[model samples]
Target: MRRQGIAPLPFAQGLALLDAVLARPAGNFVPARLDLREAQHAADAGEEVPALFRALVRRNTRPARARTSVTSAPTGLRDRLLAAPAEERIELVTQLVLREVAAVLGLDSADSLAPDQVLKHLGLDSLMAVELRRGLSAATELSLPATLAFDYPTPEEIAKLILTRLDLPTTPEATPASAASDAPGDATDSEALLGWALERLSADQLRRSGLLDRLVELARESAPAPEGTATVPAPAEPAGTLDDERSVDDINAELNALLEASGFDLD
Candidate 1:
């Protein structure tokens, strides 16, 4: 096509494209045949297609086919969320947020979004945050906050809030062993332990406790600086580029990166 070529076929692509059409079992193919009754009916109706065209159509016509049942599309998130047991909504929302937010942020994968990472730190500005909120709202069929992404800032926070909104327990039940009492300065230790614990919460474990939100809270809290060290603020996000300044392929590549990271399962 680029060379204005009328090239060879039976060619590779032509063969590949019609592999199903070509490789069809010989017996399955209905031999084209003329229908005398259909030709008589067309003549009676004074059909507009020329006689030669009509002959060609009749000669290539196959027998009437039985209507086959079509495959249905997969169930959507909203329906899945609604049909899930009352106890399972929190994890549902958590997965939903992680999947959609990662896509909007153009992240490489859903797993790369650590529970403690802030949206802004992951390149989510006001515009992308809004886009995420809208996407989550549409997916879950819930009216979420305009600043939902920034407000929660992490899947753990958003998941906890989802449970709270659904009237489920804000936190999972704690065991006496895991909740061992600690001193005030133990938070630093807890921070590290918490970081390690948060990473292991599989899709099933998210609803079992409030650990996700606690991780987010611990992460969101600011710790004091050492006496001699200075803390530097994060760099600002870049402004949007004009259409001409951006490459369409680059944008698509970024989108594909997110989907590929999602196991290419975002539909």
Candidate 2:
């Protein structure tokens, strides 16, 4: 009679079965050397092969996700303001100005005044205070009063003052050029234009190069001669040797010795 039941296989036998199952040439198995050049060419042509490989690797090797209940919050006021609408953005800017002014003027929140009225009442003396106005002008592209530093000491007041002074509509669709044109004689615009040109230059070509000075000198030299005076060519430096004593043979001998030491086959 046949056995009614079979015993469980040994660990070794179980492992062997597993190995055989894995080692079999199945449809899912991919060869290591399978036309990599062709695959690379296809990827270069913007095929999805690279993305597919990335997804496969990510899915297989990525760690298990951690269980979490906490949702992330926005970092700062600036970040929150950036995500806000145009009107909200203006409100945030006004608040920022007010905070800065309050800090600078040593005034309490209750003592906040209009920007223009503050400048008109208070006497501004410090250059540093003027610099604050310059900074604000650069940032907001607003043409603040010359006495803004002294009069409109607080940011909240300044914001309100600027808002009142501003005649332009609060449309977000206005171009930067149009905004810049409104603030004529703006130093920030000149600085920006210069900065843009400077960025295209290599740093090495600019620093400690004296190239700008040389350019100025060349410009002066190329200018039209006064009256009918003939332009004279600049004198050329003497060539051949430094002291006019060393012969060509001496230079060649030194070069040959250097080449020989460097393992150059002169023969």
Candidate 3:
């Protein structure tokens, strides 16, 4: 009898070949119709083959794209904050910080007293103060002094302390050299600085508005600050501008009066 050419292996043996082929890296092999037919045949014979192929297909699929960064939107919180005038920025920060405090105290929904009143007369303790600070810092990325919680306990007082520590433009006299630098390429730098300031102010406002807790929770699920040096203070507005009025002492007195009016029961 004439010797028969070694015909392709039977269906089971062909499936073994297919498995061996698939075992190699994806880049190394391109499957042929013959190989696919053999696999199908084997799968039809075996109970587990369909599940195996389905799993592989699912594993190899790509995920859908996620939402873009909120910072890029024209009317986003960041943009709105950046666009605000200097005085408005301070007011915004104060409101945000109080909102955060209210949220944390589980008072977000309840129509309780104003946040400042809660801080003053509702018996806020030292531990709660630190908790507030931690929450605010995490949301706004500004390091507030712990003593501020005691020294400027009310929401309004805390807002002033934050603006001061951030070296915000409280008056025209304190405007920095950077604010006056008008080099050809200064606009971009100025915008970036302004954006950073806006971010801090927004955080402060969130804290004041009883929204800090929500912000903190949201931050945990998102990208964090990149590793590097701490953020520097934003350049102050030009001295001659409306922000140029008043001295540091004046700002301090204002803060003190607010704290006193809030009935902070400090020693």
Candidate 4:
């Protein structure tokens, strides 16, 4: 099956197959290799293969093995994802899905895949789909369901699903004003929206965007301690009129300027 690009049956599915054969409910029974000696003994006694299978299955069944470190999320991946731009984030996740799918199909590269190609049409079976889901879950650090391929059905859709699960934003301009108004459950107030957006940035991202220092300055000026209480002293002011009065919108404009200087498009 592996040679033919078919994924090996998962242990859980093996147990489920046993359940169906035995006319019993599904279980957490561990699947082990069949004993040829036991089969021969049963055959010598004139018993059928199904009878031998039933007897051996009950005897060999044990608790399934505990999950291994393969399920652990890669270190610092969450921070990197948070620091990436919206479009870059989507492309990264999309490529992740494409790569996994292509590998499962034994393809040389994901370039052969169309974004909207149906996974099943590309020769993915149930077992292969399960493998794809496992790979995506481990890579993205998300607990994805087994029916991922069936639910989303395409690389593009799966990428969107992953982004939604990670609570990451899509392209900022993708959400139109009409859609925003229609979805009243969304953070509609300007301050609420700003807070939500800011939460997505990591400390490194804030520093790189040139907003961390400005934010610290604003905090000091806006939150003065009472007269007699000696709190930690603030850092020396920089040689600029940055200390001049400014609104939150003005600070946001400065961030936009910094983004533009870094070759990002504000529009």
Clash count of each predicted structure = 2, 8, 28, 0
User: Which candidate has the highest TM-score of all?
Assistant: 4
Tens digit of per-residue lDDT, candidate 1, span 7-89 = 34446656565665677766464222233454544445554444533654443344546777585643776455556665676
Per-residue lDDT tens digits for candidate 4, residues 223-251, read: 55555533333434557646444445555
lDDT of 3 at 235: 28
lDDT of each: 0.56, 0.50, 0.53, 0.67
What are the per-residue Cα lDDT tens digits for candidate 3 across 1-267?
A: 001112345688678768988888765754332224433444444423444244332221344467687675555333445556676866777777777667656575425545466474665667667777877786666877786567776777777666666654334533467654533345667545644543444433444565544434444454533454122222255657663354545444433333233333223
Candidate 3 ranges with C-alpha deviation above 4 Å: 1-66, 74-80, 110-120, 169-267
TM-score of each: 0.33, 0.24, 0.35, 0.38
**Candidates in order: C-alpha RMSD to true structure:** 26.0, 31.4, 27.6, 18.6
| Best-matching candidate per lDDT | 4
What shift in Å separates residue 62 of candidate 1 from its native position after superposition? 26
C-alpha lDDT of residue 20 in model 4? 71
Give the total clashing residue pairs for model 1.
2
Give residue 95's lDDT in candidate 3 (0 to 100). Answer: 76
